[model samples]
Target: MAAARESLLDAAGAALARRPWPAVRMVEVAAAAGVSRQTLYNEFGGKDGLARALVRRAADGYLAGVERALAGNGGDWERLTAVAEWTAAAAQEDALVRALLTGCWSERLPAPPRGPAPVPAQRRPEPPLPSPPDLVRIVRDRAVTALSGPGTAPAATVELARSCELVVRLALSCVTAPPGEGGIAGLIRTAAPRTAL
Candidate 1:
């Protein structure tokens, strides 16, 4: 079952890579994966479910990249800098990541009409909103684990977490920025630690 789920996800990603999200249909995905539509439905409920899974998978991959960057052999400050650069590069390079960041195709589908809806009014309390990623938590955990060697300072840990938040925001901004403007590298340089020499 897990193998089938993974195969469906892989097929969906491949289809997404070839074209925009609107072009990706469940029938095509099932055919690509050599599975029935029922199997895809069972694994991922529907298109929205698949999209959420894709976004979650992309988030996990991005966090892993951040972890690798934070593991570089350097002081906490340098590791944080590396993480900023790596995150910017990853967001800029990945198509799936770009889609997630930019919200492409997400606005095309209108919300279901409210009139004569299937459920009774009493039973239809507002659905819970999806929470944004806990990027700060992820980064802080990675920084603490990677930089907690003998000489690491407590202040440095806080600084790394602060820097991670700034860097991640800047990376996301770059993804959504206009094409002609300078990129996150400029933002990172502006926010870079000052040297006292």
Candidate 2:
């Protein structure tokens, strides 16, 4: 069943790459996945439900990358820079990641403007999984636990955790709006306080 669901998601992703989600019909996704329309409905309930699942899966991938970057050998700041770079680059490449990072529905679909005055509310994409800010907090909390050593002072640990949160937030901000000059590394250095570390 899980394999079937994954196959369907893969099919949906391919279809999304070719065109907008609004144009992706259930029958077509079913055909691409070699599954019946009823099976697709049973697996995902409907199109919106499938959209939520796809976003959730993509968010999970982003979080996994964060964990890997944080766990890598280096000082906290170095790990954060790695995370920032990864997120910035990934946002540019992955539509789902960009949607979650930017909180923009348009990134999840193909372009050229659809319909009349405004797009429908139901068609707009929602980050049904963890938002970028939430992901930052999760990374911050994990960093606190990992960075707290046997002899580390409690005050220092608190400061380190706050630093982690700030760096992660800065990275996310870069992902959302992308600075004209400074880039992720430079942005991280400038945003991090002199006292924070």
Instruction: Point to the candidate with the largest lDDT.
Output: 2
Cα distance off (Å), candidate 2, residue 110? 11
The Cα local distance difference test for each model comes to 0.63, 0.74
**Off by more than 4 A, model 2:** 107-128, 179-182, 193-196
Error of 2 at 173 (Å): 2.5
Candidate with maximal TM-score: 2
The residue pairs that clash in candidate 2, if any, are none
Residue-by-residue lDDT tens digits, candidate 1, 1-197:
77887888899888877777777899999999999998887766677666666666776787788888877787666676677666657767776555444445333321212233233232332332222354546665676577566676778656655666666566666566632344445566676443310
Q: What local lDDT does model 2 show for residue 78?
A: 79
Q: Which stretches of candidate 1 lie over 4 Å from their true place?
A: 99-133, 149-156, 176-190, 194-197
lDDT of 1: 0.63
